[model samples]
Target chain A: MTADALPPRTVRSAPDRLLAVLAAFDHAHPALCLTDISRRAGLTLTTTHRLVGALTEWGALERDADGLYHVGLRLWEIAALAPRGLALRQVALPYLEDLYEATHENVQLAVRDGGEVVYVEWLSGRSAVGVHIRVGARWPLHATGVGLALLAHSGQPFQEAYCAGPLTAFTPYTIADPARLRRELAEVRRSGVAVSSRQITEDTLSVAAPVHGRDGGVTAAVSIVVPHATAQAAVLVPAVRLAARGISRALGWRPEAR
Target chain B: MTADALPPRTVRSAPDRLLAVLAAFDHAHPALCLTDISRRAGLTLTTTHRLVGALTEWGALERDADGLYHVGLRLWEIAALAPRGLALRQVALPYLEDLYEATHENVQLAVRDGGEVVYVEWLSGRSAVGVHIRVGARWPLHATGVGLALLAHSGQPFQEAYCAGPLTAFTPYTIADPARLRRELAEVRRSGVAVSSRQITEDTLSVAAPVHGRDGGVTAAVSIVVPHATAQAAVLVPAVRLAARGISRALGWRPEAR
Candidate 1:
């Protein structure tokens, strides 16, 4: 949905209005001017100016020489402390690197946020399949390997609710039927790996495995994406699972716990 | 300073109070209960609870299963748009990885924030020097090689204000004297590299070079730390400078632009 469709801010609270300004920035609109922020946030020009001034003063946003506003370094510092974000990526990077070296493919670490999988980290290989993925990018839980891995391990209630959904499809192979999605998730849990082929795109296949946190719950997923034409699921599955287990161990997960 | 040292929140604005709650989380304290957050933010329990609730609903703060609050994934997604944060690191990572493969040392990418250098990326080598560096960690601008490189190129006014300061010394080898620091900065600017030995610790030395942005300004620095006893400046300097230049070019910096 476009930002212009957001509801007006007259009835929102002070904190809500303030957050609306920040929420106006997203992957598609990373930089904005005051009027753009006002229209996107559904705030008046005066309110946007005041809130933007406050945010700039507090280092939550920065204005460039060209007068365009971007997210600031201070906000990044705070966000770096998110356990599911940079902190998790920092712990999982070495293993991800090893996985990349082993397969020379695109490696990703992602966590489930609501019904979608947010990619927290991605390491690109020079000759890997051309996938449209970046750090902080999100995709539906039924369409990608990492997403399937996470959704399968997400608890029964959430899984049931997710299956009863308007499953969006990016390609012809995407699982649009809830019954098929449910079966795929069950297979993922049974095999301890998820292989998604040509779901998001026609030329790529991904192998993913769930990563456990200290509490022994699946907190994240690790995956490797390669060209589907020459894909070797047998080799890629084991490598991806090993990387996930290595990351889980690093996160204080013990095999005996489960 | 401890959280108790912050002044009361009565005089602050609404945005300031909300931001204080976010600012309460840092490297040392990434998670907190409501009471801890209230104390750190210097707000009353009621105000803190209200603000925290609003933030949690907005997905800027998340409450864990154990009831501790953490900076959330949604916040990280927004913060990823910071030009000097993950955006810069994204463009620089391949070059940084090449440098790590070449040196097999502690590689770092840092940007100057005020008078300190904030490390945005770090790649650790298994047997490399055990330096106290982490992503999002900060160090003064006069005691490390990356800091020196950034400080040298920060223009004369900022350099003068930074040098005429109470330089905190971590080791005896640190440049605490203003005149010596000026000379060191001049050398960094002249040679296009900065070499710092035993400044942060007794066993580690670093070589760094400045990275320029599309606007032709030095916006960041890249460095590699190694064991001081076996350090080879002639070899490391060229490698570090090449990595920095490569990252600069990726950021749209051209040699002919200047």
Candidate 2:
């Protein structure tokens, strides 16, 4: 499967073709012309046109007045009912807000999606430490505090396999060694807290804890991003853990009550 | 469309079938078994199985340990990026909160979908107003304050056509008459506010104002609900307008600058 022997455009099934049109859109390219979509999705002009038209008609996609396409409101409406997405954020936001108010930091709520952490909610006050992540932004499983907490509870085999991955480093403090990453994950599980210090950026640190669902399994994670220079990392750990526990209780997770 | 004959089920295309499978889980039926999906989507068991499998694999639907299917995190992640949905809500929430803090009432944000007003965001406060609408719930365009505010600004032809509808009445205050509803819409447009007094319930009043997008077009509406007995509807009008203007300005809508 060398680059020289690759097919011009691989044939895709109907469902795959339809999904490819959606995949053509991301945070980088939220709006795309038909030509851009066809080029990015690696489909012919005719196929792209038909698929886009079908999606637009079904309200899965929207065509603006300028002839640009974006995801439509109907799809957003349907997606609002996703339990793991807005529903979870809906329950966790109050606690997240309390944490933000208490600490004046960047508060985040994220869930595991495949091997990445997709932020479901993020709130930052005016004077909070800056991080460029948005609600729909994704990050690797080992770089973010929320990511570390989610990855720690993701089961044993997943941890082993992910630790073997090709880790990318933005700063020297980023975990690139498999052995160190494995040890960090173990510490995260043992302490019930994940401290990702100066991982994503040199000037920032994050304290995170897991959020459990009705079944007492870690369904999501909450974290607070603070400036490394002024952060009381140990003190922030209890605050993050409390918020996570409050959210988990709100989501129907109860050990003592049961 | 008739009550005598059943609709054609098998004639639906592959795209339609896939869309139907996603649509089968709504606010009422947020989780469904494989059998429930087949029956609700009006598809055969085999077709439902295959489409659900593909959607599950693609992260559009998630099957729980109990084998029940719920809307998945991926769809929610994509929806969070929608400008008219959570993206809009996130920007408007602070203002919505300000309005709520000014008066501890039920705050809501709604957008026009077809002829109905769909509630996109809601904050339940301690004050009791009786009409309990969830985030994704829809109501008639003429029966709610936010709905009237949005419907009044939609366009001349749309307002005219909507006023000719078979309006359903929840109470005597509800605008079931076409002529009176048209008059009320005119008042809403003239005043830049909509005050619906017990339109949907016997003891509730909602004051709403229209929200504008960057292009200065009316895109959505925001409202605050309070008890009809204790509410000074006149006093709330200014606060509602101020909050709406704040949200509009935050969205880059500049009336004077334009």
Candidate 3:
């Protein structure tokens, strides 16, 4: 096919087209060439070239010696201002570190993003059991302990809407059924913790608790992952809860507010 | 003072206008209203509105309940791919944590950006001296231990340019004289460490070492900040150097390669 043979399609807005170029780079594809971006963004080569040039000039994208483009430090600096991401993580890191120190397990902090939980901070101990969680990773609200803690505390309408869904199960123990999920959530609310055993992985278990903000609303969740075979959920619950409460207080969540 | 009283300036490209909206937010001004964004971005209200709408839809800028816009999680997720930001911090954190444990002081990992050192990670100990450094904060090249380590190893052209003149001094101990800065850089290179004594603050001292990449080039620097009154630079040098070497090895740098 010749370049001039095809006719032009409807044009996308400048912002949409430019954002598409950035969206083309994700965890699985953190680096891409001009052609790859053009193809992935579904934009013509000329458009992609112009947009990439603009983004590169503005320091949103950096082109390496290999001619592959990666996200730039300038963008990272700006993204550090994200309240729900680095900003929140910065506030919660010390408590998370304490949790790791207390348990020597994989400690994580996450927040609800619609019906999913987005991990904002993850600290993995050297000998901790693998749970496949990383910062910026997301999972369904019913699949992980942090997810459950956040889901249980999310306001009634959002919780109900999420519970009504076709819950995707990762393991046999995942809370796929609506009634069972409701029961679990209620238990989490009552006990101030969520324990998910072999839900995401058969060999791993998680204990999580909700972190509240100044307004007395659950703003995030903190969790620790351990080996399911040797897991002591009861032992981990207090440490997890303590970390969550420490973070909550750090966020200005006073006991009287609750 | 009336509508349409001032004629419009020359038009900016759509991508530039959209980028301006994102650039409007920073550490000092992390949140903004539509009017604030419009004024700061130097775009007309209607243009800012449209660009912001596009960004909001694309999850670049999130509008909170108070009608203030903040950097969104989506941007943070994308920025996580930056090689010098979270990606590098993720690799260096365990070693940095070990340094914190060993010294019971503030441990930091920083990368040179232009002539400044941008801290990529900071683990603050409970009793650590307060040096006013945070993740994503930048400091002049001659004013910090990490900065000195990075600058000393940055090669001839950059070091010469940085040491030439106009070194901003944070304290009386800061290296402001060009000849003295050159001598310090030479000593840093020879000693494989940089001890910045109360350069940034009167009561804080930092000991730092350069971290090398697989290709034998210095990529970052790791440091420990302690109270000058109790700081034993001789005791700290080995710990900081060990942490930096640990991170360098983790990053695939080998002594044989160097």
Candidate 4:
């Protein structure tokens, strides 16, 4: 197909088309050429060139020496102002670090978004586990500790919708039954803890607890992952709860007697 | 003021209009309504409404309860992959925390951008002096300890260009004079440290050193801020230097020394 041969076309709005260009880049595809972006965003070359120029001029995208584009520093600066992203991470980091120091295990802070737990902060430790969760990664509510903790406290309607998922199991031991997942969430609410064993990975176990915001609403969840074979779920449960409560208090969550 | 009475708008390209809408938000005005966005982006209400709706649908923007819009979690998730943003901070944080513990002072990480130093991370210690610096805050190159450290190592052309700046002075102690600032940067290059005293604020002092990347280029700077009245700059210098070096080593910078 020749570039000048095609008739002008339009369907999606201009803003949607421009944003689609940005959405094309991900962790694996962090950098892209002009052609790569056009193909990935499913836009014509002319459209992509115009959109890329605008984004580059506004500092939304940066083009490097190899003619590849990256997420620019200006975007990062603005994103730093996001209340639920960097702001929350900043407030929760010290407590997360303390947990890491105490356990020398993989520490994570995550928030639920549309039935999935999006990891915001990950502190890699010397202790190696096979879970392999990274910042910006997501997992379904029934397959991870933070996921279960967040899902358990997400109110009745949200829980009901999430439990209807045809869950993908990473290992044979993952909780796949809708009825059993319902019972497990109830247990999480009553016990104030979620212990996920061999769900995401065969050799890793995670303990998580809910964190609350100033308005006494469950805002986030914190967890620690350890080797499943030698894990002491009982011993780690108290420490995980203590860390979550400390973070919740810092966020101005005042708990009454349960 | 009816919509039909308005004249047909002058046509900007599709990408320009869309990008202008996103560029409307900044640190000073993080949230806005539809009218505000239209006014700020210089677009018609029709165009603004369409673009805002598209962006909201794509998750680049989020509307709050009262209809004010904010930078959304999705954009922040993408920005988290910026190499100079969260990615760099993630690697430097543990060492910065150790420095904060040892000094009990305000610890910071910054990188040079367009003749200014933009802070990427800030750890406000409990006992630190009250110097108001927020993450993503930018300041003149000669006015901050981290700035001087970065400026000193930023190659000869950049250093010379920055030295010709019309420096903004926050306090009487600020190094606003071009000649004196050049001399200070030179000394920073020689001593491998930068001491900024009572510059940004009369009650605060900062000690800093440069961090190098794997390729031996100055990539970031780390610093500690203390009370100026009772400060020991000499004592803090070594600690700051050690922290910077530790972070550099972690980033795979190998300083060849016998």
Candidate 5:
């Protein structure tokens, strides 16, 4: 389904209705008029109007002069406090910057969200290879370097379930076989790095390493994406690992504790 | 009032109660237990539980293994679409990075929110001056360089009202007098830059320039904060202004259109 596709309209409770109004918005539909919201949220126009008014007053949404509703600054302020979102990105930024400076390539920090990897931070130079990833973008857990590192370090049951099947391929090189995927994950665990070549895009490659949290759990993964033809996994691995370790240390990860 | 202070409880509507539960979390109280949220939101334990359950189910809030609630990744994804928040920061980040590279100081992008300036992005080197500013941090519009730039370019009515108010001074150098504040704003407009010295902190200074949107209105401001003892406004002004202009251009601002 498309990113903007709404789930079957089963919303019933007052809170659910209100949240459905919010759920109407996505990356593809950031701004919407009252009528559009009503349709997308599967709500009556009257209910949509009332809920929209409440949200606008509470600053969860903002209505522009043109009568389109957009997500507001207040919501952004609150979201910045998310431990796995901006907070993690803020802690990892300096290391990400150092990696960017060293590689002049596209750098990313991501965490696993169930079956997908959600990018929390991304930094790229003006001249870096074109990358489709952006903050908040998501990819399946087997199609990118950060995804592989996260999957390899994830709980066994989850890793097994993920390796079961339904792997979507973005390029010919994307690992579609369950056994091969499991083997690749094992390799990632052994080497402490994941090198994904021409997986998401044929011309792009990435090297990634996992970042640990204060409790020594793999909390996130950091990666650098470079052009496939000129990519040097050997050189990129150590830098990416160092950046990830720096972020892990900043997050209070102690290697000695393990 | 402190950042964590709650307003007198008058919230009655269903939407208001739900939003109140969200407002309970802030920079100072990012993680809260159910009891804490109940008190902060001025809701009964029963109501707080119901609202928290709804919010958690909707992914607006996440309850950790320890049962502490935090703003969730899904909410962050939705807030990423805020035109004045992450969206604006995304467009301006490359320019901010360039400014950081050139100055090796604390670089910031902020937008005016009522009488305050909300920092949307901040970048600093490991060795950059110790700055208290962080992403999502807010300050009075007359105190810091980005704030001053934003306030100077704000609408006349808003500017006049803000200038007439009780300006809280952080340091002796902060612009507290209405007349002097007005004069400083005038100079910011006349010089196309704002220089705020030892306003927020005694050891820091900043130079800032207003960033224009497509409509030729100042939508945000960019600034670089450095140690006050070595700050040279003459040297920093051009770089800050150029970064602001670069961001403005990226936002589709056209100088010829004006």
Candidate 6:
């Protein structure tokens, strides 16, 4: 159900209130005070206090010495089991490291979350080119190599919906037109790799390939970012593709299965 | 409150029941079906169905095609904000990568949770020595080198309580005696490093050092594992300590602040 479908604040259910307490936290607002939490969760002060107390006692949230609430280690421990999150990252890290070693650039792993790409892992050398994305950073499907790789393999319905319009452009090179986006996806599928040049930033270029799972479906994408002035897509394409294949193999993908 | 102080299951609160549904999933039981969740959560079938429905709707748990529930990306996104978890690891990754480059061994970053050390990050080279610990693996405070480093700097009350005995042993080299444990901790404090030789496994040895935060508190530990037979603790000690210091500095630790 959409956010609009939720009952009024006064008539919200117990589970909704409890979930809302967790929903109050996000990438931009990691830590919050009691009043901040109450206001964000849309709950009364007393109810927010009681719910926060229960969550803290259950080790879902931690209260620091400064009396601010942050996500706790126990929740991280539980979240570590997410198959598409850390579990997938663990299997892909070695391959990502190899890609970093080969290119000495910024290597990344990302998965599609709706119309956006969420980075799960990133490896960069000390002297690597500057890339502004962090581990949990998100970008639109048309503006990143990893995003393009994931969107390319996401099937017709999702690709159609995402390319329908409103494709946010990050730079002059970003693909904003629906027909051009469809052509790019077809090229990505045909060439087994995607090269997004100066799409997210004026000086950055990315080359990416899709990673398959045991079920022979594309589950994630691997990419390497370098300076646009020093871009060598042809040389980097094989390395990125090899790393993606290695990670897919580690995840139990078989060439014969394809 | 302790487990014994909680009210009977029959009269449990709604929040507690909902949390119980989540608590049912752990490392050993990462995926479960509806029936399994019902039994493991100690809730009636109807309650289990309702709670699971709510959780799945909120994207806290994902139901796979096989009808098994696994932790979802949304929960992982929230958990990524844990200060002692991914947040700490992100700040420390470049230093950890430098350590890996210098030694080409298995490198790890961990933090203490009560009397145990929980690994937050690990980097291993292709030819690195075999270490069985994963990202979320836990070990007793007196067993591994990171554990020892954390336990030594965990303050006097915690040290005393932990050294009071019943320390479990993994191999013959594990610290099991209180008096010897106390001596080792003292040496760790004096040397600014900890050496755990064949403590967790007969073939592996670890060298670790404490990472201090801005408040001059030991917030985490960095370690390297190598083959026990060829381990040169002296060479590894400086590298591990330097990495720990670099991570501490990145975390805003200043030498003059001490």
TM-score of chain B of each: 0.96, 0.93, 0.94, 0.92, 0.95, 0.94
Ranking 1 against 4 by lDDT, winner: 1
Question: Candidate 2, chain A: TM-score?
Answer: 0.92
Given candidate 4, what's the lDDT at residue A251? 96
Error of 4 at A67 (Å): 2.2
RMSD of candidate 3 to the true fold? 3.3
Residue A116 of model 6, lDDT score: 90
CA lDDT, candidate 1, residue A218: 96
Off by over 4 Å in 2: A1-10, A101-104, A125-127, B1-8, B100-104, B125-131
Q: Candidate 4: global Cα-lDDT?
A: 0.85
**In candidate 4, which residue pairs get closer than 3 Å at backbone N, Cα or C atoms, i.e. clash?**
none
Interface RMSD of 2: 2.1
Model 1 alpha-carbon drift over 4 Å, by segment: A1-7, B1-3
Per-prediction DockQ, in order?
A: 0.78, 0.51, 0.74, 0.50, 0.82, 0.70
Tens digit of lDDT per residue, candidate 5, span A4-86? 54544654887888888888888888999998898888778898899999999888999988989999999899999999999
Candidate 2 pairs with clashing backbones: none
lDDT of 3 at A167: 96
Using DockQ as the measure, what is the rank order of every candidate, best first?
Answer: 5, 1, 3, 6, 2, 4
Per-residue lDDT over A1-258 for candidate 1, one digit per residue giving the tens place of the 0 to 100 score: 363656564688888988999999998999999989988998888989999999999999999989999999999999999999999998998888778767778999999999999999998855677899899999999999999999999989999999998999899999989999999999999999999999999999999999998889999999999999999899888899999999999999998956
Question: Using Cα atoms with residue i matched to residue i, what is each candidate's TM-score against the true structure?
Answer: 0.96, 0.90, 0.95, 0.90, 0.97, 0.95
iRMS, candidate 4, in Å: value is: 2.1
lDDT of 2 by residue, B151-244 (tens): 9999889888889988999998899999999999889999999999888998999999999998999999999998899999899999999999
Instruction: Please count the clashing residue pairs in each candidate, in the order shown.
Output: 0, 0, 0, 0, 0, 0
Winner by TM-score between candidate 3 and candidate 2: 3
Kindly list the per-residue Cα lDDT of model 6 for residues B1-258, writing each as its tens digit.
Answer: 333223337988888898888888888889999877878777887988999988998888999999999999888888898999999998899889889888889999999999999999999877798788988889898999999999999879989999997999899888899999999999999999999998899999999999999988999999999999999999999999999999999999998855
- Candidate 5: which stretches are off by over 4 Å? A1-11, B1-11
How many clashing residue pairs are found in candidate 5? 0
For model 5 chain B, the run of ten residues with the poorest summed lDDT? B1-10
Candidate 4 per-residue lDDT, tens place, A105-163, comes to 78899998887898888876434464577777788889999999999998898788879
